[model samples]
Target chain A: MVYDVSKLTDFHYSALKEISNIGIGNAATSLATMLGSEVKVMTPDLKVARIEEVAEFSGGADKLVSGVLMKLSGCVKGYMVMLLPPESAKLICNTITKEQDSDIKNPMNESLISEVGHILGSTYMTAFSDFLKIDVFASAPFHTYDMIGAIMDNILIQMSQEVEHAIILDTLFTLKGNDMHGKLLTLFDPISLELILEQVNALFR
Target chain B: MIVIGMADYAVTRSPEKLTTLGLGSCVGIALYDPVTKIGGLIHIMLPTIENARFTDNCAKFADSGIPYLIEQMIGIGAVRRRLVAKIAGGAKMFSFNSDASMNIGERNIQATKVVLSEMKVPIISEDVGKNYGRTVVLDTDTGVYYVKSAIKGENVI
Candidate 1:
């Protein structure tokens, strides 16, 4: 069985959400350490949606944001994305640079944002692999500042070619005492979800 | 106003508008018949459907989408001979030095042009191919295409 989205039961859904919760918790810790601020993460929201509707789930299609994308390889396959509003990107850059005004478009700050995204991606993936007892690695980060829909179309295109539905694990992280927030999204290939479900099933039975 | 999502297409008549949002690597094709005041728009994600593992959605590929849009327009009382095209989007949002396959934006643009020409649809204007995202609106009354971007301001083509 290919273990498509339609095949996932309530148990599978809850298991997936639990995995996301643990993964995002670890990611929040990494972000808190990096910024020297307390970070709060929402319980990750899991959705099985068509590729076209994903932009709306992230926020809105026209919303301007900085998106960092990383490809996953090895045992798990899919993509990890860090989506930050321009204000959040600027705030993160300013926090690190100790500057009142930091432009996210600047090359230096762009790289900084990319590295932050990389840290979040890797940390989240680490927690996921550890919990699932699987092996996976994220590639170097690719960063772009654009509309959320534009930023994700590339990945959506790849996914659409293979499956009609995508499993999205969306986690929102907020910086304490700051109005800035960002989202980390984990999209797993259909086959990878099957492998993950197998691990989840093994743990219970 | 009707909004067309990624890998989708829509057609409308005069006094109406069609739009597609946040087009990064995807290309939006707009076709209009001036006399009938009918227009159609399609947001396509890939160049061709020939190699795609899932070929069910014709609106997802440029080679299939333009023709499909034209057919829809014709079904809705549009003259194929009088249809003109205006295109937008297909931007390389991020640069990664990998391979040609990674440059999907460029390939999408090329395929759109080829398909448009193949159908004898004259492309009057186009705003495409840069490291930015675009949102496009097509007005059926005047057959005008409005391209909006975040950093680059707005332009009507």
Candidate 2:
């Protein structure tokens, strides 16, 4: 049977959102620790959207941002992305490098951004896997600064080959009550969603 | 201005414009007939539609999308022989993955060239294949293509 993400029950969505909240909460804690400041996190938003429309859903298609991507493997297969506006990216870079102004385009800072995304993705994944009792691993991160649509179209293209729709979990976080904020987005393939739902269902059983 | 989303295409006449945003690995094809001031644009994600599971969206692939755009332009009073092409936005945004398939940007550009040649459409200009993303606009008034990038500034092809 053709798998459809829209067919997912509300219970499944709530469970999924809860898992995302826990995972992103852990990730936020890590970021807060690194920044030596409090981090504010919003409740994760979950949706099933068309692959072509995901860029706009994340933010604006033409909006310039820094994107860090990681591939998911093991029991689940998909991707995790961290999107930061230019200002946020600069703030993070300046804070980490302890410079008044640091260029995010510099190779050193670019790797720094990639490492930050790795931390968020792995921390979030660890909490998620622990909560669901599933084994999943996130690969090394890839970082780029470009238009949101440009940064995402490659992954969307790959996903479109298999499925027309995706389950997206988005969590927003802010640092030190400043304008420094970013988004953590997770895209899980339908087959992987089934695996995740199976674990969620096992709890009720 | 007519905005074409990913895996979509549009055809229009003079004084109108077509634009697609944030093209990374995807290629945007602009076909224009100078005589009629008729133009068409397509944002294609894949190299070809063959062996693809989802074939419903012909605009998603170079092989089918170019032909489909040509047909649309012809339907909108464009002469096939007078049609010239200007292309942009097939960028390898990141180099983390070394897999041959992950080099899709290069593949998309190649496939677009092949298909345009097969359809007898001469490519007048192109701004493609780099590590930066580009947003492209096709101005039907003068049959000029504008390519814009965040880091690389803007270029007219």
iRMS values in order, in angstroms? 1.1, 0.8
* Candidate 1 structure quality by residue, lDDT tens digits, B27-122: 999999999999999999999999787888899999988898999999999999999999998888777635877788989999999999999999
Tens digits of per-residue lDDT, candidate 2, B90-120, equal 8998786578677999999999999999999
The parts of candidate 2 lying over 4 Å away from their true place are: none
**Candidate 2 chain B lDDT trough over 10 residues, lowest sum:** B93-102
* C-alpha positional error of residue B2 in candidate 2 after TM-score superposition, expressed in Å: 1.1
Clashing pairs in 1: none
lDDT of 2 by residue, A65-136 (tens): 999999898998889999999899999999888999989999999999999999999999999999999999
Instruction: Give the range of the ten consecutive residues with the poorest summed lDDT in model 1 chain B.
Output: B93-102
Q: For candidate 2, list the clashing residue pairs, or say none.
A: none
Per-residue lDDT, model 1, residue B110, is 94
Question: Which is the leading candidate under DockQ?
Answer: 2
